[model samples]
Target: MSARLPENPAPLTQALDACRHRDPEGFHRLRQAVAPAMLATALHFVQDVRQSEDVVHDTLLLAWLNAGRFAADDLPPGSWLFTILGSRLHSQLEALAGRPPSAPRAVPTGLQGQALWTLAHGLEPRPPSASLGDRLTESLLARLAAPQLPRTPTGELVHPPLYDARLRRKMLTSRLAYQAKEGFKRRLGRPLEEWAFRRWLAQRSVGQWLEAQGLPRRSVEAALGDRLDLEVNPGRLVRCMSYPDAFPDRTERRKASNLFLWSGDWDLPHHSLADSSRTRFIQDLWTHRLEPSRSETFRRLEQQREQGRPLRSHHKGMLLDSRERILEYLRLYLLYMENMACFGFDKHEGKDRLGVTIDRHGRIIKTNKGLHRLAMAQVLGLSEITVRVRSVHRQWWQRHAGDAKGRDALERVAQALPECVPA
Candidate 1:
């Protein structure tokens, strides 16, 4: 028997009818309504958020394009949608299993029964064979290189990179004391819509913003191309190529990025090898105490607490987020003995370095974890920090067309794409 939908199917039915009538607005509305649930389902099976997004994106597009073929006798609307999602899911699984060995895979491999973190150097670009052309990136870089580029945060062109040499020469001849300052309005602490709006106005470029504030200029394109000769010295701060959606406040994002402090204000050691050995016993406890192995560990622990017996300190709270869950099986760097942290590709909608969809005008998406640590590294002027990067593309509705009400929602979801795309 076909599984029934949890709610009334009228909304989906209406969206389908609208799509049959060739209404773009209707199709978009439908996508917004169902994409999240569909994506959640996809994630359960695929385990990779990016792959799951692909399945949802392809499924929605296919469903929209072919909705006209459905007849009165067709299966329930929910079942039909599931059928498409399932077909896409199958294809994704097959693609993973049959993938060529030469191709880079982010599969978490077990090492000595522990999950090992994958290390990705920033300067390495994807091989040409796997290239997805990105014209949006080209456009953004060209804009940044323009002679009229903004030098100050408030759009003041006091001393641009092009004129830095001139300023240096003048300083030698005369006393030149110039303080570049921009009373940047704090855009954070506002509502989500307002935060996203100002971010949109900022063009979502953390690197450019850093340059405007007189920091060292780093070409985003160069970093993405892996052409920059950046030395990987521990604790060095690298400018961000992607804006983080995890943080919606522009002021907060800017503070986090400029200071390289994405994680938190605390100076706790994170995901380092020095602490890995100490945590090994804890790791073993977690591993062997898997639901089956320590089937009654939680129960016994609770009972001991009830009896007034002290529980082991290892009895930490439950883990959360996609990164933490994946770390249970794969050996990766854990943040503060809880979260898994790595430098995956910038999966932010406008910030994806891969440029799978070319419409994003080259904006930096936000980072999920380690924002504070990254910002702090930059603030401390370190030479290098190793980051593991995963390539990412925008999710579905990449090419939506509509008024502000419709398009803004699409873009907002796009920014939140990283939350759904775990590496």
Candidate 2:
């Protein structure tokens, strides 16, 4: 409503405070937090790109006007803006539907995802999928046998607008170099308690840049969040996020953000942990319960055999050349995972704990990382296993992370961890 500069890089809630007094700079900062996603999802529903921009502009105005009524604790500020944006898009679409037919706008429609092998720059609309089974099935099977998801093998994959993996790798190495110079002993054992704390200091900013660009930074955040060592119950993880292979072809997973609500029912079996082949493979490996075909990994590998992707960490020098060798490697991997579940997760693996996210309602949503271990944890009915926070819902952040930053934020999040995670 008005204008003033924040004296510091205040948290979103504090920025909202600046807005209460009509600081245009605060409104601009607020726009930076939520507008990218508001625009992204608006494009998904509003067919005309120009019209979508109009919808976003109107929705932000509504958000701005209502900023005083916004409650960071009751709901994430981003989610609040999204609720308004969704309504605006609905009304816009309705108005268009009521209008008489007219010439199509020459401006380009937007693209949500892209292909890996081609120059084509858009997502192929998903063909109609088979409708899901009972809601009970989604709930029961989610914690059961869902596949490692973000099913990039076949999802609408996307990346940060211009980032590639080689570039990302260089970025990480650069950060670690700075940390090393800061006197953090990368080689030494840190008390488990300090893991997340240290991460808060060094990398809380890991995916903040992506929020302005309107992407789900969860992938990178999970990989790089406050790397807390949390021993959570296997049952606590009742759901997970699902998307098709949409991680940047260059980066390992999706772009990161804690702002928008991506999807809640991603925990459903149809979404993850229930791929027929993966389910069959789990049955074959863990229980001999299914007379399944060969592991899907092998079949997938058969096609990619020409690609010659090396089996990472295989003891033998390898290529996708030998089935017998691959089988042995799979068996060893199974055993290694088993030992971690049965004997207690590695005491010496340092911060390589299972990565997880917390939803606004506090559900443990498993990420694309650590699918094998997650499955094992569920199947074995292990009571507890260590994990780290990758990213959390903005509502989760407001309640737990609050307005705190640095060690204060770390301490707040750490105290809230086991308590906020569902029992």
Steric clashes per prediction: 33, 20
Cα lDDT tens digits for candidate 2, 105-159 = 1112222111111111132322111221132123223322222212122121212
The alpha-carbon RMSD values of the candidates against the true structure, listed in the order shown, are 23.5, 25.7
What does candidate 2 score on TM?
Answer: 0.38
Candidate 2: where are CA atoms >4 Å away? Answer: 1-227, 243-254, 257-270, 274-280, 289-317, 347-351, 401-410
The CA lDDT of each predicted structure is 0.36, 0.46
Model 2, CA-based lDDT: 0.46
Q: Measured by TM-score, how close is model 1 to the native structure?
A: 0.24
Q: RMSD (Cα, Å) of candidate 2?
A: 25.7
